[model samples]
Target: MGIRSVLSKPFAAFVVREQREWEQKAPDYQHKTLKNLVSKASNTVFGNDHGFKDIRTYDDFKKQVPVRDYEALKPYVEKMLTGQNDVLWPGKPAYFAKTSGTTSGTKYIPITKESIPNHINSARNAILNYVHETGNAKFLDGKLIFLSGSPVLDQKAGVNTGRLSGIVNHHVPGYLRTNQLPSYATNCMEDWEAKVDKIVEETIDQDMTLISGIPPWVQMYFDRIVEKRQMPVKDVFKNFSLFIYGGVNFEPYRQKLFDTIGKKVDSVETYPASEGFIAFQDKQDDPGLLLLANSGIFFEFIPADEYFNETPTRLSLDQVELNTNYALIINSNAGLWGYSIGDTVKFISKDPYKLLVTGRIKHFISAFGEHVIGEEVENAMKKTLESFPEADIVEFTVAPNVTPEKGLPRHEWYIEFSKMPADITAFKSSLDSSLQKLNSYYFDLISGNILEQLHIIPVKKNAFIDYMRSIGKLGGQNKLPRLSNDRKMAEELLKYKE
Candidate 1:
């Protein structure tokens, strides 16, 4: 018997056991999670102010902790940044996951000792669940390459601060360290081009069976290897059978990614943010990820339409309905108190409460009355691409061309393609039609002659890559923005093509 045959039994038991247990206790899991989180964080400053000692139920907890966005809780975070104790959690946070903010520079999210285990466990469980479902553990005997942030981290307010991927690397168990590629020395190189070159040089010959990374950056790695070896990925990594990805919608990049593989491979999507690891694709056939209902996060949903209202309606798991879009609110062990993480999701199933991350609340193109979200834009692009099987989109972004000087107000698409369609005008019309069908406001605006036809600007190849590299967001957890309300990014990208 192989090493996988020996290790698979126990791994399957741990993963499947938790999944089934949560499924069995789905309805009451929220209550249990809330009680544990509230009881644990009751002595902190927030707890004292909110009277957490008397808070016994979800209703009481809700009343005590009014749903807040990051701006509302900035005071507490500011104090914590100055090395204050027990500002949000029991002690100072162990690490801060600094992500790009919606309007400004950076937002520091706490990652505490209690919170790290939950993140690590969820990630571990995701892979284990896959192994249990497929009965394919031979990959375990080979290398697992995680294209991630730099190993070198920066210190902020005496606490370690870095991207989530970098922070995660520090905690990888000692046993797995032997099979991991691109050593710590290589990871320390801050320049993305240098790191990718080193990673390809190091991993091209290794028995890499599994890989994990965001799609675009991973695509860069595949291109490099193929260019170097003058062969497909299947030829170079014979045992490669699994690829895991997250941090952006994978629909547009799916075809390009699979083209590099040269053979079929299984993939799973995860909904992990600096706030917490929210969901994972547990089963092979299911499209929606099963929410981590039993995790420390207490989930709440506000109907997307009412999200910007003075006082929006909040719904619990029982209160949420299938097929409804919501702004996700999370209160977790990381001490985020009823914090709206600014992401939107839709429930596809209500039994065990399965969901799909739909879009970011800030990441929308609402030039007119139509609020075109990330999911809408992505789905529209997917539909348009179906008509042209010969073409594949490498990267694309949509923004408003509002200047009267440019003729009329309309959404402008900046797209980079691996294979350009023969009929460019038809491609643009089809994309605009698909979008109009998805959003009524967009359709009405066009029909009423209030807006001009959507414009498609075919950008030079590698424009997105050059832009990301220029901005120092070419690797790790960073992603290119897909939809913007303004023309800043679109204008900057036009300069590249010109």
Candidate 2:
């Protein structure tokens, strides 16, 4: 038997137990889970005010707690962050994750003792599920490199505070830590450039079998390794076969990552936010992730179209329909109650539920009444890129040119290309054409002569990296926004155009 089999038996059993409970519990699992959570927290301030103890049904809970975004919940979070206990959860938070924010400067998200297992275990199960599906457990016997953030944390108001990955890294179980690469000293370096250099120095000669990270950052590591070894990734790490990734839609970086690996390998996707562990791609053949209903969190949905409305309708799991875009609201053991995380998703299956993350509720371009979403915009770019095999894109964002450009208002695309395309104008036209076909509202605006064709702005290399660095958002779950309704992002990008 392999070392993995001898060591990971308990984890293997845990995955089986979770899967069995998910299947056997059937349709009642979600309601059962939510009711239990309410009963547990009924004595807390949030729960007591919302009448949690008296609530026995979804309708009652719905009537009591109002949906809230980050700004609205800031007051309670602040109290909790100031060393106060039981502000949201049963007791004090074990740690807090710092999320990058615009208006608020920085958001310190709570990470309670009760919620760490959900994040860490679900991550393990994602990899285990892939192993189970393919019956390939040998991959675990070799070194697995996860390009995770720092593990060392600092105190904020007497509570440990850091990035989500760093917080999670500190809790990695002892057994699993054996095959994981990079020493603790190297992992905690604050400067990204210095941290990456150390990581390359440590792992360049290891017997690596799996790699994982957000695609763009992973690509940076791959590029450096290739430059150092004077060979492709296939030559450097012959044992590597699986890549696990998250944090952005993978389509834009798919070809680039594939080209860098220089060979085919299995991949698995996961949806993990600081708020909760939501879903994971559970099967090899299925694209959508299996939403975790029994993972210590209660789920609710609101129609995306009505989320910004004065009286939006909230739906239970039973009320959700396939193909409808709905904003996700979460309540978890981590002390979040009826929180709108701003992510929107579409249901793909009813029984043993599955879904696709559609877009963010606040991030989109609708300046011309075209109502374009992130998925539509990203897919259009993907299709257009497919036609130009020789070209590759590193990063891009779309924004509205509300000011008249010569004679008309249009969408402006800012792109940074690693390898330039032969015909730039043709590439831009193809992206615009695909979008028009995908979105009827956008097509009608063009057909009615209300808007001009999209504008493509080719940016200099490292534009995104430089922009993020200037704002101190260069790495660690911090991503540049894709679609904005106004010229905020589009116009600001011109600063670095020089």
By TM-score, the best candidate is: 1
Kindly report the root-mean-square deviation of model 1 from the true structure over all alpha carbons: 1.6
Q: TM-score, each model?
A: 0.96, 0.96
Give the deviation of candidate 2 from the true structure as CA RMSD: 1.8
**Per-residue lDDT of candidate 1, residues 351-445 (tens digit):** 77899988988889887878999999999999999998888888999999877576779998999988998898899899989999999999999
Q: What lDDT does the true structure give each of the candidates? A: 0.87, 0.84
Give the per-residue lDDT digits (tens) of candidate 2, residues 127-151: 8887666777777888888787788
Off by over 4 Å in 2: 5-14, 23-26, 496-498
List where candidate 1 sits over 4 angstroms from the true fold. Answer: 1-5, 404-407
Best by lDDT: 1
What TM-score does prediction 1 earn? 0.96
The TM-score, computed over Cα atoms with residue i paired to residue i, of candidate 2 is: 0.96
